[model samples]
Target chain A: MSDTPAGGGAGTRRRGRPPRTESADTRDRILVAAREEFSEHGYEKTSVRGIAKAAGVDSALVHHYFGTKEQIFEAAIAVAFAPTLNAPAAIADGPLDGVGERLTRFIFGIWENPTTRKPLLAIVRSAVNNETAAAVFRRLVAAQLLRRLAEQLGHPDGELRAELAAAQLVGCAMLRYVIKLEPLASADLEQIVARIAPVVQGHLTGP
Target chain B: MSDTPAGGGAGTRRRGRPPRTESADTRDRILVAAREEFSEHGYEKTSVRGIAKAAGVDSALVHHYFGTKEQIFEAAIAVAFAPTLNAPAAIADGPLDGVGERLTRFIFGIWENPTTRKPLLAIVRSAVNNETAAAVFRRLVAAQLLRRLAEQLGHPDGELRAELAAAQLVGCAMLRYVIKLEPLASADLEQIVARIAPVVQGHLTGP
Candidate 1:
């Protein structure tokens, strides 16, 4: 809710410079601020104004760049899962025999790292708390990741097959990370891959 | 708070009823109240006093019957999952090969029904919202359901296997029921059972 200025507008831009498209740095700041806000206050309580203030931009700029709360949420989750979304392309190049092991390892490996895990935890917690957020998150996951993976699998029921595989991984993440249930929580990563790979394989390629 | 019936502490009972060990009706009322309070306020903000007030019983009686808030939470969830907890025994009695179909059908059947689903949704939402609630939920699920299911499976890592199976179902539920993702959400119950049963069977009985 900052004022435009004495001359009106250009509040977030430099004083002497001509107005221009938002800088990449500025865009990154907004996304980071949005992640923190969504994590701290959850999806329902967070606002564009809050994200803008946190990023040192105006709400108008946030709106201009991201359009709506749902758009911003989708953008935020896309960034968070960017690393994850890259995997299916790489994994598809691999032989189908090891697809399950590679896929499981790839997903859980991302989760085992604190850097990727933190943003993901934020996205999941927000999504779980609100249906609107869940819908947004669901859209991003299906479009960006699961659908692509499904296409690679080449099943008649490819999307459902992809989703079932995803459901297994999502459930493991909830149990191991979010809920921190013992046994599964403390099980070795490689061991988890060994155990869960076949189930994922069966989901994707089973009769 | 109601005046304590002259002797202080039998307000939930009618005067001259000479209070026995809390009637079944009173116990059921308290359980129902606890479920509602936990559902509406979530685990962190819900209070014993709130539950007692909702049930029209004194806080002391709630404490006396259920002990602490955690215990009460467990009791509340136990009631919610009572039907589920019974499934392991029944399924174990059947041929091991049919275990997956029976288990999947049994679980999704409960979810397909509104009567059992309402309480379960409450428990899942509460658990998802708070770590304390998650931990409590983890313990109850492990102790009551997964362990029994695992014991019957006769795998060395039976607990992990059982948890892995639960994780897939839990994830599917979150997506279909909680997130209301399309296709999966609107998918037929028997179709889901048919699709997912083999993976569950693989998890339990596979090498």
Candidate 2:
């Protein structure tokens, strides 16, 4: 493998160093530990050392895998939100007219599955509680998810449109899944889709 | 004024005890203390003694005024959200067809003002982080704001419709004000209303 930098600079020294197997297994182990530590202690309380301890790895290894607590939180979010990364594809594959229902259904489907919902609640709760965590969440949702969704929109205000639609769905998730507000929380899934799908479509394709 | 108990009952005894001027001034001071305590120490770390100390009152006085920590949080939220209590009136006083724009504009108007929005941020942050705080926040929003708005809608699903609309605005607040996400956060007020008011209307009156 070429550890050779095309042009030698400050970056070259780090690149020239041998990879210490920031391998998939090692990364996953660290991320799982990070998630557990975050869940048990919250963002303010969780530490890199604590996460390393949980992962049964040295503190240096944790830092090597992820640079900071915020970065680690971002990494954990990326994994938890992995299924949603497929969402833009779903929109692109569908007929433009049907994008609304498809996108709405797709998002709700992720939350309907308990496996996805729990971690989402954790990250969302973190985002609400801490600015550093919110910044990571904001960057990930924008860079990874919403930007693609915006591109699929194909409008002058595509970015705005995507965010508007996101605000709608995010609100639903907060009330239904997180806060569990009555009536909306207890409402049938179909009932929500029937009402909300058009709004999603409108935000995507409407004024 | 007569502290008269017409009937000898458990509730009557409490009613017969003269009002200690749970008067506006005393009540306001206790709530200010509560908000300050919750803001400084957060929900878990804050205590009745802390609030009472901060208010320069006895713990018993704090109990007499608000009953418990959760109750104090509720009272604080109620005070913070007082401006919005007038909101149902905004929907009621306006023409039925224009309810969406008026309602959206009115809600945003409250948030637009820093005076009202700061305490709102405090209470909402508390709600997201603490279940006990969340419960108080939920109960007040439901009872004070949404219920009245639901009545104005006059639909079979008026309660559901009201909740759905609340979710929409709440999500925007989370993203725009709380998370401060791009585009949506920077988007002009009218732009939001133009896009969101119709969606809000659709929730209220649409099929």
Q: What are the per-model DockQ values?
A: 0.58, 0.58
Task: Specify the poorest-scoring 10-residue window by lDDT in model 2 chain A.
Answer: A1-10
Question: Which residue pairs in candidate 1 collide?
Answer: none
Q: For chain B alone, what TM-score does every candidate structure achieve against the true structure? A: 0.86, 0.84
Candidate 1: count the clashes.
Answer: 0
Model 1: per-residue Cα lDDT over B1-207, one tens digit each:
233334356546667655444355577789999998987777777899999999999999899889999889989988888988888976877799999888888888888898899888888877876777888888888888888899898999999988888888888888888777666888888788887888788778877
Among the numbered candidates, top TM-score falls to: 2
In the range A62-150, model 2's lDDT, one tens digit per residue, is 89879988889888888887888889987788688899899889999999999888777788878877889889888988877888899
> Distance from true position, residue B140, model 2, in Å?
1.3
After best superposition, candidate 1 residue A151: deviation in angstroms? 1.7
Worst 10 residues of 2 chain B by lDDT: B1-10
Task: Compose the digit string of candidate 1's lDDT tens values, residues A20-94.
Answer: 443655787899999888877778779999999999999999998889988898898889888889878868877
Error at A117, model 1, angstroms: 1.3
